[model samples]
Target: MTATPTPSRPVWRTALLGSVAFVALLWVLEVVDQTTGSALDAEVFANGITPRDTDGLVGILLAPLLHGGFGHLAGNTVPLLVLGFLLLLSGVPRALAVTAVVWLTAGAGVWLVGAPGVHLGASVLVFGWLAFLLVRGVFARNLGQVALGLVLLVVYGGVLWGVLPGDPGVSWEGHLFGALGGIGAAAVLARPR
Candidate 1:
């Protein structure tokens, strides 16, 4: 009798491919944004979640894929790849759902309480993945996850400071809310006992 392929084989393949594709999309968008002399910036930033602006609601969907500059995009690429890969290791469906929750939660929170201005970047997702990685193991009670979280904490813990207000023109609101969203996603999606 032929043995069935282990489910983990497919899960890993999907995680790798999806993570690459998502990061590739971020690069492509940034290339276009750069090529246009940042004309795309005005359009994207203008549409970005503006507190109390009903018309800017769509920023919740677009903001995660948009960045203000190549420098901004460059900074987010590695964390997005690493944490994103780890998140998707759980399975694409769950990962995507978590991303959607984080995206909307961060955007909405920014809209509700963020300072008045245009906020834009992939940092929201970066922060989301960071927080998710930091807490998912606890929520799921998986030793491997716990170990992975510890490793990530060592490597990326510094970024967590972004959650606090600092640096003019930086969107601490996005970081704070994205982290909160990650916590919420972890709680909601935890493995049932």
Candidate 2:
């Protein structure tokens, strides 16, 4: 008997969720940055603001949902669309799981490796998704799809460099860590049974 292919989750739902959540997140980020001052700077979270000294643990995770400005948010919009679509295509639960890992992993990594002072952004999410898709395409051995993935990579992969330190206030650590998180996702979730 032929092995039945697994069914995928509804992309519509995932898209809707991505749309609503990220949009709200952007708006919230705008408000917080303006009112409380731009917490996007990685330094806010990177410092030793321990619960006793300071409390910004929340910022590391929440920063992605916020943007520094319209240009920043606009830059991420397309990537988010692609990632949301890919997750729906890959498997909603699995995609969500991967994203979560990337989020947590990237945040922690940034905290550990990021410069003493910098701001956070969605770069990690973008990095992780890029890594996840690249890994998935290779593992799947789907030539046509992988070819398309390569093209996409060529266009977007350049941004991954921005994640690295030395670019002023940009949080390279988040990018590196987030990329690792994405890679880990592919390693575990993308594994063939």
Model number with the top TM-score: 1
Question: Any residue pairs clashing in model 2, and if so which?
Answer: 40-119, 41-118, 41-119, 42-118, 42-119, 43-118, 163-172
Residue 54, candidate 2: how far off, in angstroms?
A: 6.4
Query: Global lDDT for candidate 2?
Result: 0.68
lDDT of 1 by residue, 114-143 (tens): 988878888998888888888888999888
Each model's lDDT comes to 0.85, 0.68
In model 2, which runs have C-alpha deviations exceeding 4 angstroms?
Answer: 1-13, 16-21, 31-54
- What is the lDDT, from 0 to 100, of the residue 75 in candidate 2? 78
Cα lDDT tens digits, model 2, 19-77, are 55765677666666667656544344443212221254675566576566667777777
Model 2 misses residue 138 by how many Å? 2.1
Count of clashing residue pairs in every prediction: 0, 7
